[model samples]
Target: MGKRFVLEEYLAHSTSNVMNGITIQQRCNDKGNEAIMTYVDHVIQGFRKDGFLYILLTVAPWCRFFPSVRNVYKNIQEGIAKGNALFDSLIDQREKELDTNRPNGFIDSFLVEHKKNSPSFEKKEQLRIFLKDLLAAGTETSSSTLRWILVYLIKEPKVQQKVHDEIDRVIGREGLARLDADVPYVRAVIQEAYRVQTLGPLGVPRQTTTDTTLFGYHIPKKHTNFKQLMACAQRSKTLAQPRKV
Candidate 1:
């Protein structure tokens, strides 16, 4: 409940809040589309700009649950500092390039929107939060998904061959698959891969808001606790069908 209150306060007033103060007009505009598109574009740009594929790859899982994964990120930062000097140089160069090129990218779009909305909002601070959220949430999860998909493809060569054959017949080597393209097989493969990989092994954690009674037991108010384990609650053999929450 305290955390929820803090989140609400941040959403209401924090200058760095990512989802705050977005207008419907802005959502319906080309600027919005560009903002969304540039998110992915800048990440790929950052990867290329930095030449830190391994770091980018690691970021995928970290971003999925940023609130919980911050400690992990701090540890990683410390570990990287103790490693090869050339890698550190590459990271520094990437940061400089990002700082230089950011104005031409998503940060620019966001700044344009912010200027239209609240002129008082500090654009630089907002940009920092926006970039952090994008890097932590966007790049990491997608990269991890792609990594798992590639691993699955490697494990099942026949599936890979079928996909390759389809690509050869349709787009060929020179062309790449577009998001709007009618690629059912590709979509199906991705769906199956995610289903098998199951990124949220434990699912997102939540806390009870108030005192509640369940199955004749009194759960105290403001208790930061998770529900009973699914495996413990339901018999494995009896679970034939999955029900929606």
Candidate 2:
């Protein structure tokens, strides 16, 4: 189900940098790599803990929280600071490279929008929030999904063989320059993995603005949480049926 967690770490670092120009060291024989991995580990731990604390913080943020929760919050704030620093560095670097033909990442895109839109301070704050989300969500979802995919692949050898055969037929042994969108079976396997073990087991929370009825069970406008998606998916009628595989 895993590859020693380094794959997840590398993916997280690389994607986060792609999004915000943060420079994380690659898995190399260097002290910088160690520091990069340590920072990423902190950020990842914060992501894991934030989900549990979000419910409590959303409802009663003023209440005394656990020391561990405080630590997680601090770790996330530190990560945010690192991201902000990277954003500033990218802005300066981009300004100097205005005439050069370099590829733009997410931060570059944001910089262009900042000039065109003249975003407000609040908008800048929101952008920072999105940067954090990009880093955390990218890490969590990809890693979690891959873990589930690995489990399924190991459990179903025929399925793995089919995937191999398909890859060979479509992209060949040399590997793809980029994955084709027409690959149905590969996409299906990922979709199925998401259904079986959703990364965000708890669905996104929302507040009711007015009284409403949902499946004939709700009649109030008060705040409430939705049923966990993973639980519902597992209990779904379609999933209940036995499969030939």
Q: Choose the strongest candidate by lDDT.
A: 2
Candidate 1 residues lying further than 4 Å off, grouped into runs, are 1-103, 119-126, 203-245
**lDDT of each structure?**
0.48, 0.60
True lDDT of residue 222, candidate 1: 64
Per-residue CA lDDT of candidate 2, range 109-166, in tens?
Answer: 5556666788666544555566556555565666667767878898999999888787
Clashing pairs in 2: none
After superposing candidate 2 on the true structure, give the runs of residues whose Cα lies further than 4 Å from its correct spot.
1-38, 47-103, 119-123, 177-179, 207-227, 241-245
* TM-score of structure candidate 1: 0.44
Top-TM-score candidate index: 2
Global Cα RMSD, each model? 15.8, 5.1
Model 1 error, position 132 (Å): 2.3
